[model samples]
Target: RIYVFYGPHGCGKSTFLNNLLTRFEDYANTEEGLRYEVVWRLNIKKLKGTNKSAMSLSAFEKLIQVIDPENEGKHDLEGKDLAFDDKEQEYIEVPCLCHDNPFLVIPKDQRRNVLDELIKNDEFKWKLFTEKQYEWVFKEEVCTICSSIYQSLLERLGSPSEVFSMLYARPYYFNRRIGNGISVFNPGDKPLRRNFILNQMLQSRINALFQDSNVINYLYSSFAKVHNGIYALMDVKSHNVERMVELHNIISEGVHKVENLEERVDCLFFALMNPEDKRNLREFPSFEDRIQYIDIPYVLDVNTEVKIYMDIFGRHIEGSFLPMVLENFARAIICTRLGKKSGAMEEWIKDPKKYQNFCDDDLILLKMEIFSGVVPKWLEDSDVKALDKKMLKKIITESEIYGKEGLSGRDSIKIFDQFYSKYAKEDRLISMPDLCTFFKKLGDQPKKIIPQGFLSSLLRMYDYSILQQVKESLYYYNEEQIGKDIKNYISAVTNEFNSVIRCIFTKEEIYVTEAFLESIENRLLAENADPTRRKEMREEVLKKYTTLTLTQEIMIEGKDISETRLFQSLYDRYVHNLKKRVLEPFVANENFRNAIKDFDTEKFKTHDRRIKRDVTFLMENLSRKFGYTQQGANEVCIYVIDNDLANKFKNA
Candidate 1:
């Protein structure tokens, strides 16, 4: 099968292949990934006087010259003694050309009959392989040349047992460099052909056994080298029509025809082409159907692009040297690559109107988070949950046009190098200011891919981000838990009173929890609400709260309750009171500053009783209103002072 990765240049097509090679290498390291190949061994002592000599085969011709070059074509040693290397008096070993399985050497028609005999040995036990796996892997026929060699050996040896004894089968791992089962075909002047080199030591013996002068048959083209594995073709469309036809034939028919030989191939073929090359490929319609096309586009994901940068350069930097600002650079480049979302994309979104509401920055942030497998705030209650991998994939597919236009990963790396070199030379850390200076220069360059709008928008997002950090640094207290506690208390008291009021409304058993009602009324009242007005307000709250619960089914949205308007107004009033009673005093009082100066609770208590009381009230308010624990509140106050957050955001 031929797989073509077609896309624009710099879209990481080559990176994808490199990653695949790495993955296969990892798999080959595993026990189960070890497949077997056959090797023939010849007893050097047995053929002493026979016509067979070490230089008999064409394949051994070169190895012999390299090992025993001084002997030239002729050697004084006779037959079996000719192959004996005085250093190691062992039999000659010849590996199979295609990593051909031992059982596959048997003729296809006779394989079924010989299967039981082949596996009879404990070494070839069925437990090592399942029936289907055995069949799929071993079913391929040996290469034409190897088949000829094996047949000649079988005839010379006389029996299967004799041939088996003269051979060994062991695990073989596929390696691209060795060309055992992996080959890459690059465009060149001449068409690909099978080649064989004769080992001089085996040439004489192999020549005597075969009629052809080309004694040893070893196939050597990119196709032949990867006979049973993988074949990669870079820029395949650049090749001539004849080569294209050959590729088409091999892929569709699973055979390569050269002269009289119809060689069967069990290789996975991969072809890479840029978008323009793919456009030219239309000339060959038949080839189109035979190839599976995959698009290897640029990294549209901010995190993934950042990771690519980090993986390539992060190791060189010291601990935490690469600040969050580096991610801003990545996001800017990614934003340039993104096009506006299509109507098709909108349809996939849970709410098209909701998607429309997002600014480009928000969209980019959401898309980046989605790509990184994180659900954004906008999607929390939406129909398409973050865990829906399929829908997320669909969104990516719909936005494929985005990745085609960005600055290439290579360009980004170049900019990163330039920036690092500039700052690191001056003995300064790679700060956000340094990054911005470099970015401005990049944007100013003529005909650069970084769009003006993209740069400006990214900078805006960066400034906002910095401001947010400043705010978080100042209000370091965890208000989230405090807010939760407030809501929970309101829910508990309201539900308890509602349950008692329900029986009175039904007239079955009258019961009124006046204490709870009055407590809630007091909290809801403003400072200006006098005694007379407070009494009226309390009566109005009871009337509305009881009437709605008894008649309506309320559906709450955000902080609003549908049961009664007073609930929302009351909650707001309590929050306002909390902010005024706690927040104002802390900001206005000098003692509050001293309390947070080192977060010394004992000193805070002694410094000013009024400030201490207000500080305690603030923590309780946060715990009661938001849900922060005492320790959490204290930590927040301490961080704010320790970091000098007030000064950072003082002007802003």
Candidate 2:
């Protein structure tokens, strides 16, 4: 069968093909991916003689005669480690060809009976070797050369057991370039020939006992080289129509017509072509029918796109000189490729209103995150509850249609290469500005391939990300104080809960309150359900909480029941607002900003504890939180306050 991989240019079809071949080759050589082929010990001299030089002489070898129950052990002779015994024979080993299995050497009429018998054996009884694979192997005929030699050996030896004594089996490895089993053909290659690949020993056997035989040596064609393996056409359309017809026959009929010989080529066929090439091939209905086209489109997932760069450039480019906006650059290029959501997708999504309000950019980004295995942060309980496999499938199908439109990673890489070179030559560090400049030119070009609002959106995101980073640094710097405040709030809530509770079982005062206990239960169970069920659930919760309180005294780390997700979610929201609260007073009040700039320590002392804490917190933690030195952080804080950089992209 011909498997054609189709995609737009720069979608990594070629790279994928090459990598697949490499990985397959590596796996085939391993023990788990083990395959079998037969080898024989031949005697050009006499069978009974102990000729020491026979092993050294390559001319004495004749690879023929397949055997049942062949050994599948690794070849020890592959290494130089030699252990010689007096009883060992010095015979030459020769591997058989025509990609024929050991079972094929049996007479065609006896094959089914023989296969049935072999399958009964413990080694062949396993599910690893399927009946279809056995049938495939059983159907293969040894090459004409091997057949001729086999007949001669049978006539001379007069018994099948004698023939079996000369043969052994080991792992078979496929070589892509040499076309031992796998052949990859590119454009402008010479046509396959029927030239016989005569063995050095067999070349002199023309007038021997097998003189009347039509098969002295096997014919070596490009088609024959990949017999029982794989034949890959790099770009099918690049070749002439005649060459494609040859491939069509192999794909459809599983046979290639050699000179006067319709040889059955048992091989898998693969082809890689762009969308235009695929369209061109569609004109020929017969050829199109035989192909199983697979799409190799550009990746939409942001994380996957980032990973491609990470793998290419390695963990850190130029020893930690990797630009912070490297991911931003990847996202910008991917954004250009995203297509609008399809109408077909609406059928999959039950409530279109849930997603109807989202802008094109927002939808695209959400799809990207979804493709990267991220759930949307804004999803409500109802929206999440409505999701199923069918909905996801439709969403994926919609994304697949859009995948054909995107600007390829290759296009982005070229732009990156140009700017990277500019910075490298000038001995300057790469930055987000360099990437922004590249995208600006791409978006502004006369024949713009990039989307209209791409550059502006990216620049806005970059500015916002920078500001967000600064705020995060501020949050981390004051984390100790924030933790203390959160602890105080928790303590106050606990005190109020303890005061309201009454023990149900002991008829004594209980520490746990009903409302507080219900909150924990609600996280795991339903809300506002049966009273009896709720009471029973509360008992279970009380037991776990009592254990936690006794063991760790309500310390968050020591508690067994999970509360981190809830606590963290609450903490993040609180701190997010706290950051804004801290910023608003400084941003709005010019007098407060001036004090911050002038380092008015005397005036700072006169303020309330909260204001004083905020003032001292910024002064102390800028360097430690962010990646800046003390002087740099101090300067950056003042710059941000003076320019009001936090709200710079607010209008966008």
Candidate 3:
């Protein structure tokens, strides 16, 4: 299979390839029955023109002279009489390209029968025969050189068993340094000139066994090194463009012509190309179908981008920034990589203005969350229900076209270094203000890369989120009293006004009146709701009580009224409104603002008992509920109060 991974440069294409190689090696080592061989990484730019030689006795004589420079081998000897000094030692060098697998040394006609007799496992035999990926094992014939040697040895011995005994199997050691099994070629590496390879000891042994046969030596070529293995081209530019053109036949027909012989190359061909480098293959239009191009786009997932930062800068760097601030930085960088408008998003959300408090106008932030495998809770229930399987698939498919533009991976890292160095401090944790300031301070040229109005929307969203966090942390309402209030309101709405009744759920006495119903209704309904709207809301609640809550919950199932779905929905809104107003009184108090700043200091001990207790409880809950440090809690609280965030998002 020929696969070309094309993407923008510095987007971790090479890193992904290296990790894949490591995984393949680990899997092959652990699994003894794996059918694949070692992957050989090759830089096509380093490959030179092909050269071939004849497989004659004179070639072996020339090879013997090269290995035995001291004239240790008999020059006039032929066949069995050919002898060399130190014949027992295997010190002769053989080119890795000339090496062949022991299984390939067998004759093609009898190889399958031999394997069927040897392998006892039925499942493995079934796979080897039936699986498409393993078809090469039985279909591929031996190389021209191995076939010649096997035929010659068989003719001399006249026995298949005797000839097969000479062939032995050994472990293949993949060393990258010497280009043994795994070799990585670079653009700068010079191509080898010498194509002939010989080992004197092995040649002498072969000559003694096959004295009358014509086969004496075999020719070598560069392609043999990666035969039946992986051939990875680093990039398809520069000299590699020519090399890719040269592999047209090998890629199409699984064979390469070397002089008079055809070499069979069953290899997994892989290459990495930049988006611009794709033009290099334009001259050969036929390659479009032969090569499979896999898109390796920029990092769109915010969490994965943060993990990349943590990997480079260390995980401890997260402690320097406030919670979600570091991720927000990553989110900002990823937003630059996304398209400004999304058809899928627009199709799903017809109006982006409705979610101004949660998402940006472009919905890039929402898309980033989805890319990170998160369905944000802020999405409207109707929109959430509309996210069926087909709609989700369209959204995910749109990601392929994005992450191609905007800030590259290298650019993001450099920008993060600058941002971190400026804001990370020892006195206080980094906050949203620092993040906003860093991007705002950039020059106009760099700012043009970011989508317009995104920063303002991001700041608005951050402000709204932190305000809710502060409100939740400060809220200490009584759950039992709130439940009683709801039950009393439901009972009052169902009955006539000015009537006195005892609550069934809370077992508390209540004097039902218009003011009593208005108090709870004020929290559940809009503040500006007119008298008629309030009356309509009361009637709606009463209708629900008579139809579902009163008849089914109380009489049919005998479940508490609070356990009904209608009650839970109202309870959520009541609590949300209460938390929204929890920080109102404290924001107006100057002592509360000073107390948050003076927290953990000696001055905090002198504050009034009630004020001190409230501050302490807020800070503790901020740390316990949210993953905030003491310093982070103090900073967020001060930020919310000083910015008048309560009033800023009062309607939200």
Best candidate according to lDDT: 3
The residue-by-residue lDDT of candidate 3 on 147-176, one tens digit each, is 665576566557766655555544454444
> Residue 580 of candidate 1: its Cα lDDT?
31
Model 2 lDDT per residue over 1-652, tens place: 5788888888888889989888888887789986777666665454535454423312233222111123213223465553322233345455666555655666677766765775675765554245675555545676554565567668878987677676676667888767878888786776645333445554433323233435444344567667767778777665533466677767777665555455567777788887667566666787766778899878787767777776776755432222335666667767767765445434434454454323234455456666787776556556666557777777776776766865776865676566555654333344555666766665444226555665555555445545565666555336655444333333333344557444332233444566655553343344545668766654543454455543454464654222434335445645665554446556776655655554544665655566556655765665455454444444456656766766763322
Better of 1 and 3 by lDDT: 3
Q: Write the per-residue lDDT of candidate 1 for residues 1-652, one digit (tens) a residue.
A: 5788877778788788878866775676479787778777755444233434533444454456546767544454445334433332346676775677777777777765676565675655664345565675446677665676666666766776666676688777777777667766566646644433334454454454444546455433456557667777767555533455577777777877544556676777777788777666677777777878887878877778877877888755432232355677677667666664544345445444344322243355556666666665535344554336676677767676667776777777787677666776323345455566777776444226554454555544444444333233233333454343334434434344445433322223323354544444454555555768766765665565556632453433332342346455555555544433333334445667666543445566566666555566555654564444455455445444444434443422
Query: Comparing 1 and 2 by lDDT, which wins?
Result: 2
Cα deviation of 243 in candidate 1 (Å)? 5.7
User: What Cα-based lDDT does every candidate model obtain?
Assistant: 0.57, 0.58, 0.76
Please provide TM-scores, in order, for all candidate models, with all chains considered together: 0.66, 0.67, 0.82
Model 1 Cα RMSD, 1 decimal: 9.0
Report the alpha-carbon TM-score of model 1 versus the true structure: 0.66
